[model samples]
Target: MSETATVFNQQLAARSAGGSTDAPPPVRHVCVVGGGTAGWMTALMLATTAYGPRLKVTVLESPQVGIIGVGEGSTPWLRGFFDGLGIEESEWMPACNATYKSGITFEGWSTKPGFQRYFHPFASMLDNMTMHQFVDNVHARLEGADVHAHPDRFFVAAALARQGRGPRARPNFPFDIWYGYHFDATLLGQFLAAKALERGVQHLQRHVTQVQLNEQGDIAHLQLDGGEPLAADFFVDCTGFASLLIGKALQTPFVSYAENLFNDAAIAMPTPLGGPIESQTVSTALRHGWAWKIPLSNRHGNGYVYSSAHCSADEAETELRRHLGLLDADVPARHLKMRVGRMENQWSRNCVAVGLSQGFIEPLEATALLFVQRTAAALVEALEQGDLGPAAQQRFNDSMRTRFENTRDYIVAHYKTNSRTDTDYWRANAENMRLSESLQGVLMTWLSRKPLAAGLKAGRFGGGYPIVSWYALLAGMGIFPDPRELQPPTSHQARHRLDAVDDFVARSATNFPDHRELLAAIPPRVGDKTLQLYLW
Candidate 1:
């Protein structure tokens, strides 16, 4: 046998004999490479979980490497992460220039242009009703009843967003709305790092010069520049696109989603808050791709994601500036190249890749941080399941793969269903973009019927976007079947439901505080106990 294979066998034999090894060391220490939003988030979650006291987590970050701080929009699941970490909104919102995000508003995606718009609200699309009720409402609309209104009108969150209002402070109406945040990513990373440190996570400022692998091809140690080699039982690659530990050292293969999702680059910049902070993220479809306008407390995070194959960087930047009415403004636009795919295995051997290191599928839906958060949460679950063996690794990889592909399919659906053919980019995306088999099935199913909760109960990931999200996108893009196809409801029932929704929207708009006013009302700082009680 070869020397390496023989050594590996000898080590296994010694481990089996328990001469110097015991229970495979129990994953006592974890080393994280490259600290950013992903790095700090992983460290903080792992260091604060039930297993925190048993594991020692250390972060190796270099000051030279800069961060891409343009990921400001987030989904509602972020609130769960914050609450689980015992972090109150008042603690991080001010520090990160955050503003409440009710949901995303899509504009000009249909062929009939005149700035057509729709909202994908964070609230459940349907009230406490069954699919039969939804089908009846659609049929009633077909029978000359004025039961038709935009889907957002039924959601209190969307209604508040329309009125430039934030959440209400009603004691009895706690579950009436849902919200997330738009915050500076760099500031969020710094905030999470401080929390992790306070929870006993070690922070190191050093660059990883080389990664050393064991005989069995697992990460054994990481060599730092002008320092000793750092050893750990497990490693997390938060090294962004470089993917030092998982991609380079562990040799995990990457699977590209370029064919299904075409936008591969973005030019981002922050502008001064031009108006009152809007409670929703505005994603306007542009000629080449789309532009995101995320309103924060102090500034607007703006970016144009476009296909590099269709438009040159100069042209894209010009179009973005023109759209923003900053034709001659001297703001610097930072260009970013996106790798539109995920690694074949997020957890290979003893290394787990997080955030941009694992994969990226553009920022169309603000999915980068969601992926990071899910991966970190999955890692904790895997670690808690005894030793980090092959079974745990396989399960983690499968779960992460499901999350990434599910997100990719959702983003691809946006381009595939868009009816705008004004530009070559849109035409190509609508005609030539490849669809995954799963998404193809979904589209086919929706053509015959509306998406039902039972139809989407088996989503690959645990906490993925729900069926309501699919309904919003499909109905908003004008892809649903004729209302005549569904079962009909009595005229009295249809009128009652429609009037109820209108009444709810009117009351919500009247009661909620203006977006800016609510933000200003929040105390600059509050103790944890007070903030918890206030939010809870």
Candidate 2:
């Protein structure tokens, strides 16, 4: 390189603002309170990516406090999170007792004959060929014409799960597959903590007795129960429902989803595996709420998410026990109270809220970890922009606020459209009229048999889930005229055969190995090696 060119590049890299050559003080330390998946994930991402070697991260975790692990499932986003860190599935999956998840299957939620069960699969390569056809049929069905709109028949993930096949394809496959996973949440958190520590993130075992604030109301420092006061340039709250820093100390307002969503309590228990594990979560409708059966490599994670207002905890637990065929078994159940809402200001002052501290919209779609990853990644971007003013803070809040509300709407739609009327719980959900304008617009468009694309393009219904996802939820719930009162479509496009779609999905499944076979193929390892290998 020439001397002149080298000097020019060096000069361009120099920082200056307002005719001053000096730059602002760098963010040197980030203190994360609470240590489960959220805290460790935030620390890991920041330590490894955000500020390079210039920033140090510390996680203050209470030894006694446990995380809400009812959501043992994850969306496809987890795959990306692991990949971005250059972690391999073979290594991590075997360590966490995790298994592939093609998608979730809704059972008994809708009692309609053919819709008694429907699979809502993750996005797939073959969906491009069939998603439009599914939407076209949904439009036709809503317009008083008989059409096939069940989501299971249109996508490859559904097919994969149904055939007991893994969601990933062989090395030679041209297209990539998107699927989630079911894992032991506790093990997964420990795995992340180990990974974070290996990369220079600090782990402190201390209980926060008090949170100090500056005159500007920003978090100043933390007082530990038996340790020195700790301070950092920035703070992250992963304290779950207690919301220590973001809620109590920062005093951020919260927006509740009580009216839109009613389920608030869950009774979780573990059940032994009976058959070959399938790549799907089965959500069966119960009298009070729903029961989730998540498949793990060794044991099945079972839980009943119900409304305490509709049924007592004892009753809810009994129902869940019965659902899992554990009524006579001596298995213990862990009950959890859900604080269903989002913080009004997730990023207030110098603190950013992650995981349950920020919000929770139930685990119907298994999106708990998705929010954790998204917030951590977004926080990195906002920090990189080098602005922490009110305007910049407000912009981040607005973006997250919309995301939370949109996710809430999707979960709410599941109950509002349920076909069960056997109990007051189901009836109340079906009669729920309190809804966001965004959700109302989407449902209204579907009811009117108009294209959903219009609402999306016009920004009427905000984008939380994809347009195809909305179609799957509605169409999967059997929201249409009675099959006995149906007639064939009048339009040729609507009447076009879907034999090709069926054949394509069927053929695609061939590229994937059976779920049981795939699980067996992972190189043998002593169970949960991270726990044995990674010592704080």
Off by over 4 Å in 1: 1-25, 113-115, 124-126, 129-149, 458-463, 480-497, 523-536
Per-candidate clash tally: 0, 0
For candidate 2, write residues 67-128 as lDDT tens digits. Answer: 87667999877876775665778878989899999899999999888888988877765677
**TM-score against truth, every candidate:** 0.87, 0.91
- Report per-prediction Cα RMSD to one decimal: 8.4, 7.6
True-structure lDDT of candidate 2: 0.82
Clash pairs (backbone) in predicted model 2: none
Clashing pairs in 1: none
The lDDT per prediction is 0.75, 0.82
Alpha carbon lDDT at 126, candidate 1 = 28
Pick the TM-score winner: 2
